[model samples]
Target chain A: EAGVVQSPRYKIIEKKQPVAFWCNPISGHNTLYWYRQNLGQGPELLIRYENEEAVDDSQLPKDRFSAERLKGVDSTLKIQPAELGDSAVYLCASSLDLGRNTEAFFGQGTRLTVV
Target chain B: SQQGEEDPQALSIQEGENATMNCSYKTSINNLQWYRQNSGRGLVHLILIRSNEREKHSGRLRVTLDTSKKSSSLLITASRAADTASYFCATDSNTPLVFGKGTRLSVIA
Candidate 1:
């Protein structure tokens, strides 16, 4: 089966501009996740979805960051008026079922560069 | 806040040597997983150990979990130059999966 897919392997935008990343989870997967990884650091969970319901998103910055997993298959993460600090890799992952006790399949990720 | 923290932020070893990495979390978890990431690439799942389990081996990879100490260790035997990458430990709970800062391993050929 095809693994998780993400669009725009790399993106470059000026600071204060809006940017969005897209993700398509694996087939039959019931869980999706969005994470941000900075240089020399591990990925930080931005949001998680159990189908259409966002089960965990407390770490998301509500002021500028927004995410939506429509139809429980594809997801989009948007950052409005992004800052220079927003430059990083945005990763999407998926699992077969249940949130815990499962290994996640990851996408190539979209590397965003905010100047 | 419930994220795992990996010890020895970075490690360098010669090819054919063994490299071990550790991860410690603050809370209980349903399972712990190890992932590897190449430079500027996505991550690949290595292995997972459930809370009720203690050790698991996959090829050259060996994982050990100690719930009593809330820590896990990953051992890679006969390391190769291709093993130069970052290794991360993720803890699973009722909350979202959170990854540790990761340990960069550089294996010299």
Candidate 2:
């Protein structure tokens, strides 16, 4: 089976411009997550989706960052008027379901460079 | 915000040597997991140890969880050059898995 898939492996955009990243979780996976990993740092949770419902998105910057999981399979994360600090890797992951013992599968991630 | 914190931000060892990484988390967790990420690639699951379990091994990888100390350790024996990567520890408690700043391991051949 194919793993979680993410598009635009690398993206470069000017500051103040808008950029979007897309993710398609593994087939039959009910739980998906979006994470941001800055250089030299671990991935941080940006949002999480259980099917089509976004159950945890408190960490997402509402002013500039927005995400949606339409149809409960593919997810999109958007950054409007991007800032230089927004340059990082945006990762998507999925699991069979949300639980304590299950492991997550990750995508290659989209490396966004805000210049 | 991140919960788990990995010790020894970086490590360097010769091939065939053993590599050990430690992680400490704040809150209680139902399970702890270790992941490896090669440069410019995605994170891959290495192993998972449940709270009720103390030790588990997979191939050359050994994972031990200590719920009382809220810490875990990952041991990779007979490391190879291919083992060079960033290792991260994650915790789950019915919530989205939270990761720690990873420990970069360099296994020189």
- Measured against the true two-chain complex, the DockQ scores of the candidates, in the order shown, are 0.75, 0.86
Please give the lDDT score at residue B32 for candidate 2: 90
A77-108, model 1: which lDDT tens digit per residue? 99998999999999999998765777899999
Clash pairs of candidate 2? none
Question: Taking the tens digit of each residue's C-alpha lDDT, what string does model 2 give over A68-107?
Answer: 9998999999999899999999999999989468889999
Question: Candidate 1: which stretches are off by over 4 Å?
Answer: none
Candidate 2: lDDT over CA atoms?
0.94
- How accurately is candidate 1 docked according to DockQ? 0.75
Highest lDDT scorer: 2
Candidate by candidate, in order, the iRMS in Å equals 1.6, 0.9
* Per-model TM-score on C-alpha atoms: 0.97, 0.98
> lDDT tens digits, residues B6-103, model 2?
99899999999999999999999989999999999999999989999999999999999999999999999999999999999999974658999999
Candidate 2 versus truth, CA RMSD in Å, comes to 0.8
Model 2: per-residue Cα lDDT at residue A47:
93
